[model samples]
Target: MLIKKIKRRIYNLFHPIQGELWCLHRVLNEKSVFDENKDLEISPDYLETKIKHYKANNFDFISIDDVYSKRLSEFRYCWQKKFINITFDDGFEDIYNNAYPILKKYNIPFTIYLSTDFVDRKPLIWWLVLERIVLTKENVVLSSGVIYTCPDIISKRSVFKQLCDLIYNEPDNPADTFRRLFSNYVSYFEEKTANTLTWEQILEMCDSGFCTIGSHTVTHPVLTRQQENEVRREIEESKRIIEKKLQQEVLHFSYPYSFWNEQVQDIVLESGYKTAAMGYGGSCRYNKDNVYKLPRVYLVEEST
Candidate 1:
């Protein structure tokens, strides 16, 4: 642990940034057997520890709005106080059930990027579907007519990644495409989406005043994989739906699956978002970073 801390400090010394936008998905009481889902879930206890550690280190917990406002101000590259903005993607119910109380206790301001369709009862959450498939069966047949065996953890992990890539590149509706492909093994996809938040719950979070809701595309498709028109519709429609429902303008966005390109960024900006966040990157350097394609640190249990 000491060495890890030292190594982080050395890395930061060379790669300095103004602040970190911490990206997370669900805050669960316990992790699941789905290995991919484990990367997306962190315990409530772990969330609290992270909050405490950042506070102890004197990091300011700011909102997504604040992150945007900083861009307009005079940004000094040297001797700056570090800030942290916590963000949750996909609007999971566990965030309300497990994470909100802890965040409220610390009085931390956070953002939630909603896919909108999650609440509207659309989207298969393909990775979880893949997890269910691999864990349930000893051997699986791929779309390529290739038979993959995963009787053990090692093979399961490998096959999971392989399937995930295939789904990620699915140009058409990924949920529909994959659901049709794995129909026999994935009847529980609809039931599994119960884990996501409802519209009322989302509004309740907004009522807390600490939560800033952002658009994460309507169906949460990988924008880069879709046609330009489809990408535009996804970006614009989600923001439109969110703003209409919340009676407040949505100012930020998070790319679904962290997959985006220059064209997608243009659509996000034209759709009226002040900033757009990507899933993986170290931190934000105020002066140098592009607001449209801002990078974020994906925080899991083992993340520092």
Candidate 2:
């Protein structure tokens, strides 16, 4: 791991990534490698390390809107320096708490794609509930009639992963099964108190000029699993809500769970988002080439 970090630093210095859109999930002060969704998180200090690294390498911290407006050649004028667009997914409160300060300190521009319901006092993220369910319960009897006995944290992690994959791959509405699991283990009142970023915090960020807010859909559903009308409503309503609250044009959209199809792309475009971000790993060569489905490399503590 140390060697990989060294190599990456070397590459950042020697072989700078040009026009990279880096996607991050949550940033907290915790350094433990084992935690709920550890792979999706980085310590606040580690986030600063990355920010400093990019700064030292002369990377321009660009926003999603900037990418949409500028041509690749016209924008990336620096022959040696690279340009990066930093984005955070899911709108975790930690992003407002831990990350916003680090980013504010560096004066780096960034965007957050919000799962509106996650923030808007509605249903909380089911996956987090799933994680809690697996960790706390010694044994689980799933609706499928399979019994999982997680005797330790290791076993819990393994079982949690299997169940998560199973939920995602199932042919039915995964939300229904996830709710069933949540109720079986976690309290419905917990759903009411899933305090994500509040409207005031989001407004402050938008007013800061360093942050741009984008839509991450209403309920953060896997769009492919829903019907066309449902998907359209998900894409449209989220953007509408942000625009209404912020009183500014919300111009970017991101796929919830990095799940996007042709239908999803068409809806995002039709809904007036100028550019949208998607997951998995790669750099965008040109903005116009992938305005709707921009590729991003997810930043994690351990390099692969």
Top candidate, metric TM-score = 1
The segments of candidate 2 whose C-alpha lies over 4 angstroms from its true place after superposition are 1-17, 31-36, 71-78, 120-122, 181-183, 186-194
Model 1 superposed RMSD (Cα):
4.5
Model 1 spans > 4 angstroms off: 1-16, 120-122, 143-145, 169-173
lDDT of 2: 0.77
**What are the per-residue Cα lDDT tens digits for candidate 1 across 1-304?**
9999999887666556788899999998667565567889899999899999989987889888987896324464446677889999998888899998998899999999999988847557777777877877798876556788999988888888887767656676667678766766656666564478888888898898889999898888778888899998999998889999999999999998888789888888888889999888878874667888788998867644
Model 2: residue 149 alpha-carbon error in angstroms:
0.7
RMSD versus native structure for model 2: 5.5
Lowest-lDDT window of 10 residues in candidate 1?
71-80
Worst 10 residues of 2 by lDDT: 71-80
